[model samples]
Target chain A: MDKSLQKTEQEEIESKRKVYREAKEQTRKNARRLRFDESNPQPKKDSVDSPRKRFYRQRAHSNPFSDHRLDYPKSPESMDWSKYYPQYHDKESNNMLQDVEIADIGCGYGGLLINLSKEFPKTLCLGMEIRVQVTQYVEDRIIALREQNKSKDINYQNIAVIRGNAMKFLPNFFKKSQLSKMFFCFPDPHFKQRKHKARIITNTLLSEYAYALKVGGIIYTITDVEDLHNWMVEHLTEHPLFERLDKQWEDQDKCVEIMYNSTEEGQKVERNKGDKFIACFRRLPDPEI
Target chain B: MKHPYQNIVSTSTHLFVSVQNHLQAFDVEGNLVGSWKDTIGHEDLLKKQQLEKIEKLNQEPEIKRAENNKKVKIPKIPTPGPGAPTIYNYIRDLELTHDNKYLIGITDSDKSIIIFEINLNEDNCLKLIKRQTFPKRPCSISIADDNSTVIIGDKFGDVYKIPIIGENVPEKDLKPILGHVSLLTDVLITEHNGKQYILSSDRDEHIKVSNYPITYVVKHWLFGHDEFISSMVQFDFDRELLVTGGGDDYIYLWNWYGNKLLSKYPLRDLIEPLLDESHLPPERFLHEDSPKEISVVKMITMDKFVVVLFQKVNGLLVLEIKDETLHLVELFPLDYPLIDISAGGDKIFGLSEDKIITQFTFNGKLTIDDKEFKGMIENNPCEVQSKEEFYPLYTMNTLRKRSEH
Candidate 1:
């Protein structure tokens, strides 16, 4: 065979191998997209059978004005959290010895809790989302992850998600000084002047948060909205039981990285290239009068 | 048999009388001095009256000729069901300050309690000073002894201490001092050994006693009522003695501080006679085990007399307490069930379920005082026609003052 003929055949073989590799990468991308959120049923792309585009829209829910009914356990002691995180409890013993030490208020999509669970495997974490469907989705995601990693050493057994209005029932789930960390990632802004009270961070709510957290417990808050971020920082700074930690301290925290990268809202903000304001505060020890 | 008086509370010079939809003021002579109908109820009443007038006009031959003119219609208003908030909210309870200068009353409506400044010093000027509205409907209210703070217990079992002169207090500032686990039925601010405490009873049969002002520390739970604890009163003579009546057929007297049940007075036998078949709706009894649901609707306690009104019963039991023993001294029967009763100035006035106001005179005999009210006879008897002219402090003349109507 001539040299030119041999080189032409080799080039054809190389092009075919490149096509095969590109096809394999496309298949992997499809698999990852399929597993993004099974709870949110998405139809196949480029199909006329699916009428609704953007199936799971990301519109923030407004503040509940009237007839806001959220079920709450009678007391912190009365709540059977084992149902939310069954693996935490010993099946044979049927006893729950561990309590959730980290809580995410308004845990929309539960990105923070999932990420924090990896950083603090021994500490139990809970995400409380008021919206029923969002809570169910987060719960389903956790369940799926738990089942997927059943054989692996890394299982999501220490995290759980619950449907609850954290503002009204924070004390109902957490005993005094039970929580070490509380996360507030991208909460509803409630922008209107009349709706300022509906904001999650208030003087009264700060007292409640202080009661639930330990003396040195840290409150991790991040928001793309500057007004809400400022409102939270002002409230936490003004609160007698809390002292705002500077940006230097926040940069050193491991939870900050997971909080910025892990939450669904955080990822959305990253994709949009929005400015995120992060603030962390440590609950101060009670003053000896 | 005439205008029904459900609850009659008296000030120094006048009585704060509550009928079905109106809280009227009257002298001891039982004349309507001034009255304020619930604004909500007033709207309903006006609509009903207008409809009746239209109905009469429709029957007339002139209406047929002018049918085209009457084409413009009035929108139908929805009727309020049981426990529904209506325009004319019922006056659940009322209280007068120590000086009898301010009269505060809580209605059955959500988020509002009306306050009236009674200037009987100048004239029989009963002016609605303010409407203290909040996010939550107050189930029970107790005026502090100093008249500076009003303690309100909401249906959510949260107790809030509202300043009487809170002109511009924000809603967030009024956080709950203490909370119960269930719906609160009644709350009272009682003082013992110079320290004030809040005694609150709930539908869950739990009477929580908490330290007032600083109410986070729960003192005790006086828990004995089998069902919803509806009415509670602290003995005027003895601060420790508490009398509570509820869904149960008996009234329990408890030593609150000691957390001890002193006595349980059974009213089942006495209440049965008052429970005439006519009083109860025929449909209600068709269901199984309805008779046992008979509860004490109201309990009015005085120094020596205790008046107990049974649910679905027309008459009230007047028991005389002599040496810590209760004897059924009087059982005043009525054609209509008594809705509320209040005792003041040595007289008991019972408001029936309907528009009948019966006065059981000092000796337990029913007497009808003159229906007409003698006008306000004060040192400076000035008749103010409009609420705007009377309450100059408030610019908005809300249709709250019943006397204006």
Candidate 2:
């Protein structure tokens, strides 16, 4: 073949390669959206022990967004899966053992969700917001994370924020001993006498906390409200299933980190140097009747 | 009954929505679970109100400092009652007449605007009396140019008028003034070039100046920026020139009477020096995406600096309209959505959508001579509308000279 012809063929090959590469990138982008977050997930197992081991098994796969391998809206009687599922699992990342499952009872702006998801990839954290605007925010953040390949490593899959009420739905998602920890940080401290009945704390509620936890599970709470802390202590103590975690143990508590790094409200509470109070309680063994 | 969070997975626990107050979460077996107290039904605002009571008492001659110091702080009780009404899911968008008594404020719940009669006793405190409710969630309200009638326009583009000082007149008493289809975002009672007109701006992008269906004059429709039309004002100092801003980024200025398009006032881009000392802060400011979803979120004016809310920027703002352009002044402390802001005489009152009414000077002062306000916030207890009354035990500032509607 002549030299000119050979050069023309070389140019054609280069252009074809460029087209192939663009097509491949397009395919990958499409796949990212279709593939739910399946990254680094541990199969449901009998080992309720070994938080670290559980972390690895859960983090064994890769996908930016994952739905715990369960279908969205696991049941249709309540929230529509279509609206709730699209943004469940966020950017897949390396799993880490420190990750623990968290439920942000009134997650206002996914600020808490983002913080917890990164802090404990081993933990599956959820932000529950009632306001559609804020709830949709968390849903988007999870998607952005997955699309960015933010969650690719570590020992566990970290987060799944839902738009629902922890007060109304706690029973729906969690069972006795399911959550190793519970965080009621910066809850409303209803102050009026008639409204006192509205405070999230009461002798009865403390019992609910006791019932939700495992024999050894712990409840961590914080507030800028000094009076509310007193209310929490009173209720937590009166309940039969709980005991105040010793102050010594309180300082060493790992859950404090999540509370400190929570969403907009938490940050606001922190900035005002508002009177902040922290409380911790453990689920004591149910005694003989 | 309202939860701003999701319902967790099913367990035996359930709290009936009807048992709204003082409800604790209980498993299906009737075992008490979580405290509904902490969630929707929590009374944090009440506690904050009581703290205000103590603060107010701290000002009294009777509650000696030593005596108050010695009294053990009751964690739950803030005060027995002399405080701002602790309202939940209510409406707010305030328009106070110059004297401050004839306040046209709206309650967001039932979407009603009320004209309240005001009286300030010896102390410069505030009192609201003779409340007449209208059938509209008012975005802007103004007393008729003659001061004979109160005109209020709702989000749904209905403007109703009631006699300012008169017998309780329901819907029949109302005269349909400015009727349109979409939201009528603003209404101004202005006299331009010697003729009086009701200048109304609506979602339809038209600002109509007229006496209504009888005969109408359409102002030049401000046709440029596109977004939900929010607030429109005839600059207090210069009622002829109009300044209007809304969901759109730009604030447009129009000749209030000539119907001439003047200029556009835009929020500082945070990068401009015009933002001055009031430059948007880096942290804690409400991010852009938060407030736009809900329209009619801010209420502003021109004479004083135009106060912008944080729903768009997550901060309290001041837009100083100069040469028809906006100069972003220093942002203030008020957060979330500012429901209503009114200025007249020597004071400015900012009422939050959450029922927080903050009064301050053009400069800044923590305390005001609210001593004049007798029966409104400082003295209100359990009140009866037609014939009911609630008398609580501990009373201090609760004793007002009292007035009857």
Candidate 3:
């Protein structure tokens, strides 16, 4: 029995080392593929491939309060969206064809952006993720999809991903009432009593969301945690600028159906047979005092 | 032991200073008129009283032995270290109502807003009228122009509006009108063309100007600073010109109403010689050999000049505004570091690190005044026993964001 136990321990350590070696090899290959230099200025349309998710796995949670070093425009006017959407750039005018009207906050794995691209083909949709590796994965995934569908009519030119802390300075990247739809799908649920302030949805963050959304703009939220869902519902219902949409409104909305099944977290919940709760709120006109 | 006055406010008839947990008011002649102390040690006193009662009832000796045995079996949990969160019961922010009828202060111990009715004739000038507690500690306070509402910004990035004189509403009934996800540094309520607006700055280098009362309606954001804003003051001569300084290397002058950047006055050339080793970044970044940083501690405007103080620096920078531009006029050096400053009438009173008040007058040139309030107002004794018991004398640098996960 003692000999068998020793042999099993040795095997476990060997297996762990093998996993680490595989991850390191995958990282090297990914770096080589993403390198852009004078020799390889642009890749052939069919050569681009989707990045593997196993090579880009990161921790599920990130603290919203910490000052993560991020690159963001000083204001909406200073933001040059042409680089993010090169196909839509107008060379004569030195500007993009349209502004980003849809935002997916904490868009993990590019699942929802992929689904939303087809639903709102004309609208420019952007995903904002805080984690470094996760954001790069989404960018690679979008690039691969766009290259793969170059011959199709509905090319994936309208979707883009950026690394940003939306909680701190959403106004810095977008003008007043610039977004028509904002998604908060499966955000980090800071569960500690003292950490409730770090939760993505709160009374204060709602005001910023309201500022970015035009009148009648919709904010869609879904989560697997019932407690977080209740907290989001309570705060959104209390904010004067946001009015909760009823069940009938949720039933008729096509985006709600897409949101329920698109994200990676939602699929994980579906596999585990867990409950999913969704709430939608509409931005109201400012009151005259 | 010397205790620096953390806060000093001057009114027309009296001067008030907060030392540790004590708030003392003095008349123009430097006579201590009235005083108030925070209820800091009441919990310890109650625990002592309860233990004495238990000791008296346990004279049987059998119960005592059993208790001793249980104590021996269970080890006591160690006390938290310096980095742990501790409840400090001292005045964090103080402001006077527009009418000057009441003095408002927020206590850090209980997170309560205390209102005092100022009566000079009575022996006890400060009458504790109302004490209302909130969910978070209030970091900055501002009274509305109409004097009916009190706007408080807390460390949790929420701005709440409470009535100066109104019914005692429960804590649950109170709600914040606006908020930021980052920590709030300063909040101000200013008027343009008879319309009130709220200007709030956060640690994320954002200064939002929103419509007052209807605070849900955001007007615009002033977005030039790459560092957290530590202080913001409106130009006395031109309300449209907003002056802001913070953890950055420069101060910005803005035409807030028009959303234009008028000027950016760099401070590194002026303050680099004054930076010492103590001005280095917090311990986490020591390995990087990063350069020292400067944070603007306090700023006040007088006539056409703005008096600015940097954290732990033993000097003051006076800037003259010309053509909507900020030009450094003079740097008045001091013997000791300055803690806080207040402007009263034509005189500027500075509280230094040595626990004394230095007066300065600005006619055509800045000169020190001969008047002294050392023996009278600075003689009050505090109960601090050791260096660890004293509260922090400077906290503006803590507003700088750290690169941590």
What's the candidate order when arranged by decreasing DockQ? 3, 1, 2
Candidate 1, B1-405: lDDT as tens digits: 233344567743567866444677877665546767776544544475578657865666766748656653554655668998334346657878766778888765536677888765444557887776555668788888898888888865577877767584566576677665456788889888888888987765567777666564455566566567888876678888788887777788878878778778888787776665543324622446546345676687766667787765767677766554567777777677666667665566665434344555555433444443333122112234453332121111111111111
Model 3 chain A scores worst on lDDT over the 10 consecutive residues at A29-38
Docking class of 3: medium
In candidate 3, which residue pairs clash?
none
Off by over 4 Å in 3: A1-47, A91-93, A191-194, B41-87, B287-289, B375-378, B383-390
- DockQ of model 2, rounded to 2 decimals: 0.01
On DockQ, the leading prediction is 3
Native contacts retained, all candidates in order: 0.00, 0.00, 0.69
| CAPRI-style quality class for the chain A–B interface of candidate 1 | incorrect
Interface RMSD of 2: 29.7
| Candidate 3, chain A: TM-score against the reference | 0.86
Q: Candidate 3's error at A25, in angstroms? A: 12
- Candidate with top TM-score is 3
Docking class of 2: incorrect
lDDT for residue B250 in candidate 3, whole number 0-100: 91
Model 3: per-residue lDDT, tens digit, B186-294?
9999889989989999888899998898887788899899889988898666799899999999989999888899999999988989989889987877767687899
Q: A87, model 3: CA deviation in Å?
A: 2.0
Better of 1 and 3 by DockQ: 3
